[model samples]
Target chain A: MSQYSEDSGYVVAVDVGGTSMKGGVVTRSGEVVATDRRPTGAEGGPENVVAAIRSFVGDLAARGSSLLGRAPAAVGIAVPGLVDDATATALYAANLGWRDVPATGLVPLDVPVLLGHDVRTGGLAESVLGAGRELTDFLFLPIGTGIAGAMIIKGGPYGGTSGWAGEIGHIPVFPEGERCACGQTGCLETYASAAAVARRYSARAASPATAERVAALTAAGDPVAVKVWDDAVEALSLALATYTLLLDPSAIVLGGGLAEAGPLLSDPLAARLGERLTFRSAPPLRKAALGVSAGMLGAALLGWRAAGVPDARASWALDVPKTSAVP
Target chain B: MSQYSEDSGYVVAVDVGGTSMKGGVVTRSGEVVATDRRPTGAEGGPENVVAAIRSFVGDLAARGSSLLGRAPAAVGIAVPGLVDDATATALYAANLGWRDVPATGLVPLDVPVLLGHDVRTGGLAESVLGAGRELTDFLFLPIGTGIAGAMIIKGGPYGGTSGWAGEIGHIPVFPEGERCACGQTGCLETYASAAAVARRYSARAASPATAERVAALTAAGDPVAVKVWDDAVEALSLALATYTLLLDPSAIVLGGGLAEAGPLLSDPLAARLGERLTFRSAPPLRKAALGVSAGMLGAALLGWRAAGVPDARASWALDVPKTSAVP
Candidate 1:
């Protein structure tokens, strides 16, 4: 609902995933002025992916200037990997097959450039604009392909010393029970992540089905689906209970694909987490409202922050976008 | 060696433990001008303990006034419990058998008073004067009769909402492996706490021996002691590794009674934690340098802050106290 006028400046924001690159031109008030996308070309090699990102940013910049009558004041990029936000460098990304790439330096723009991890960026967006609004302390957990967390402490995203603070997925929930791709045992992601649920269900059911289908099947009283779904809920709740004992957040916002299951996910998770916690009470578990566009919006907010705009005016406090992508 | 002149000012600081109450009259530079101790009288129940604390603080205030040639500027009390640091209220202390006691109100003093949890206060002291000095991000784990942690973030103590942020002791390490007194299963404290080590050793050896004696026995090649010590180290390392994956602390400072085991505790712990970590490197494990007086010193620091004094003048950067009690 935010409108951009002639005087309103713009920021270019991009969110790079394993398969696609999402880019947007956003006004100061967080309105999407223009948008674009491109295939990551990841399978082609790291150089191809890097080149694609450069072309995407260039296109967005040109489109932004034409739409806003001026070039963007700043650019913000979010990538899925071990990103060092302080230096705007992608330290390492296994899926992207890149390391030590200075992402901010790759963009040949006149404005300031900022870079951050994809999950943290999405959490920041949700915290400021979606379900987490008005809460200063909470955890934004995105149960996507692999589980990750964005810790919102004192009203802002908290990246640990090595920019790897919210690796909640890697926390051993089963204690040497199952091996993880990260060379760890019993990681929460190994059992509870959306990809894990689908893969495990498919292996047992002898047919490939998305996590969404598994949830539907469980609701319809499918025995195998029920077992798999119950296990995921139990693992998630246990990990959350442990986190509650450590940080004691005010609430936990469940985002990403798995959370889209709505009551099916929240209901069982609440009951299990409540049972696990004895002394300390379990925090409210709310679903994220921003959907998939959260990463792009969060990147835009960071762009405004890089342009020295205050957080209050920089964030999107408007209603959630109805479309799957940024409006 | 900070010399207390008549005009320099002083504060009364108390650290109330399960067995004894340690009180001190501290100068501006963390020097203990006078000190006293009293039995907690816990067997007489909560009211008796409260009365003892009142008498101890009143006596310390009188002694401090006489020693400094003026009344103390502030008072700081550190107790083992669920404390509401903002309101100076002791919410609950299982050891002290008190709940919802307004400790500051009981002081009946004109000076500002501050109350905090014992572990967090020790962490604050370590952050300013000991191993954690100059580090903004770290975890302070004290393996005493019960395990607790003080999380130092952004160069200051972090007391979570309701002042229960660092209850790492209660985190289910074994997940239904052992029964803890708190009615939990396989808690980190159940296996790794100093009291647990001593009690387990005493139970199995059929002769009473403290955790210190068990360490000595392990060094002398006692099979039982070696097994018990190895299990303790494994449990502690597992819990610490999980914490590292979550918080990514720069270092972990081990304090309290068990840390007195020195290399026998740290060396094995460091190696085990390093082996457990895959993507992220293990943080350095360091023994607490402030000894048992960390609580008293930290309380004094809080007293100075409460009295509106600058930190440079309030810190004990001069010398390490050699005496068992505060010097």
Candidate 2:
């Protein structure tokens, strides 16, 4: 917990989501000395959310300073939607209702700041410290309220062309299946997202239930729940198979709420994904190690990078090893 | 016809396909000083094909030696297989019936040699000299007897974790549709390959017709031909949409015999692709500029790369001039 100058050695790491944001004060040696969460005030619109985030960063830095006696060396942030990492700006996030919000606007501190796309930042954490530790190329797929993937190519997250890459949620997995909220037809997210799974099951079942309840009900052989779960699995199988063929990922790291169902989801999903690939074997699916904290940890890595300590995570060797222990 | 030296400026280039192989002697300045073609001898077995390639390469080098007053400086071969470029070995090609064939086995000359996968090598050519010029990321789709793609990422072709990255044609576009020869159901290849287009049209129409003839008939308003063509276009739209959503490529370059239909193919594909992508504009569909010569030219680039001249193609302006090109 004590490395460098203790307080001054840590960085303020934040993961900003549409509904809420998670913040932490993390040391260079991969220790989270202080952590907190707060509502993003998104209901009050983009400016309110920005003010909340800036206040949160200030509070975290002040807490760290009190704990160890100095200001944080740098700040790292993860935000939803399009990000221009080169300029450290949040280009656009439809859900956040913001465009071109510079990283400077999100932090009250005067230290070096860096930004990353929310999903890709989580992918970076998974790549550096979690399920994908051994992989140079893989897909980090987080399935929760919505689905998106971070394509880890040549050991880093790849945001193609205009930073719009990894919109896997919007891809049409079942071409004639259903309409998505984004106005696309037969999207994978329409059936496979945790929110979608619960929504779909509730629309057909006798009672409304969470995705967790749906998983348990399906496992207990409830026919309606089973049908809904099977559709999600089928949709995922198609999308995963397509990803495998196109990217040939070493493995797929699954995280977020849907994955907490554990083997109940992985077992059938794995079998179906294998069956779909005719010429090549299916890439193994591994559970994410960092879970919901991946983005925050990844921001810590970005913070470390900003502080000119690239090997800090490497030296710590926390959580998982190069030969990942996620299983 | 020459740049480095009049006596030794050229390299031997070969594009080895399942049925035939194209060979060329290309100078550093990007001129094909001589060219030839021959059977791959695949039916006679892998050894026969290897021996045939060696003889063909020797003959091309001899021709270049007489023309340039010296032996070629390097060799580049594009094979239809999984290639370990780092080791210069062709690992496997089901069609070519080869395994563990070293690049040296096909090149009698002692100069440096490099091997690349057929599709990716062609994509490299497209990236450096053809339709994908000036673009850092794009998909080069060639709809021939079969379908495959070259995913040009970061100004070069990207082969995935195990050199199988761009198998775009095998993606399941229609989940419950026709089974493919690869034993996968609803593959883009099953519905959209030139052979598939010709075969489907022939099966439904009174008379048999080639894919080129089918394209002509579709243009002339033949219902059967139009149906087959439409299915191909629809399959293509779905695959491209999926690709765009996943990779966000700048453009998609269409090549091969079917692409010669020009507006007959691109017009409907562009419209349908745009319709499929609700949030993002569809990437423009461009015609592949180099045609059948793409693979051979890519092999030349590989040859120059093997000879330690990475910028040989950049030295010559083929399409849109690179900003670094000399005045």
Predicted structure with the largest DockQ when compared to the true one: 2
**Candidate 1 backbone collisions, by pair:** none
For the predicted complex of model 1, DockQ is: 0.71
Report how far residue B293 has shifted in candidate 1, in Å: 0.7
Residue range A1-327, candidate 1, lDDT tens digits = 223576578888999999998899888766786777789999998888888888888899998887777788988888888987667788899899999898665587768888878988988888888778888878999998999899888788888778878888988777857798998888889889999899889988999999999999999999989988987897798688878888888899999899989999999999888877777788999988888888988888888878888573434436535433654
Instruction: Give a tens-digit lDDT track for model 2, residues A232-318.
Output: 999999999999999999999999999999998899999999999989899999999887789888888898888888777886656
What's model 1's lDDT at A307? 87
User: Tens digits of per-residue lDDT for model 2 on B165-213?
Assistant: 8898899999999999999999999999999998899889967889999
Candidates' chain A TM-scores: 0.95, 0.95
Query: lDDT of each structure?
Result: 0.84, 0.89
Q: Candidate 1: where is the Cα deviation over 4 Å? A: A1-3, A312-315, A320-324, B1-3, B205-207, B313-315, B321-324
Residue B144, candidate 2: C-alpha displacement in angstroms: 0.6
Per prediction, the TM-score for chain B is 0.94, 0.95
Evaluate candidate 1 and give its CAPRI docking class based on DockQ: medium
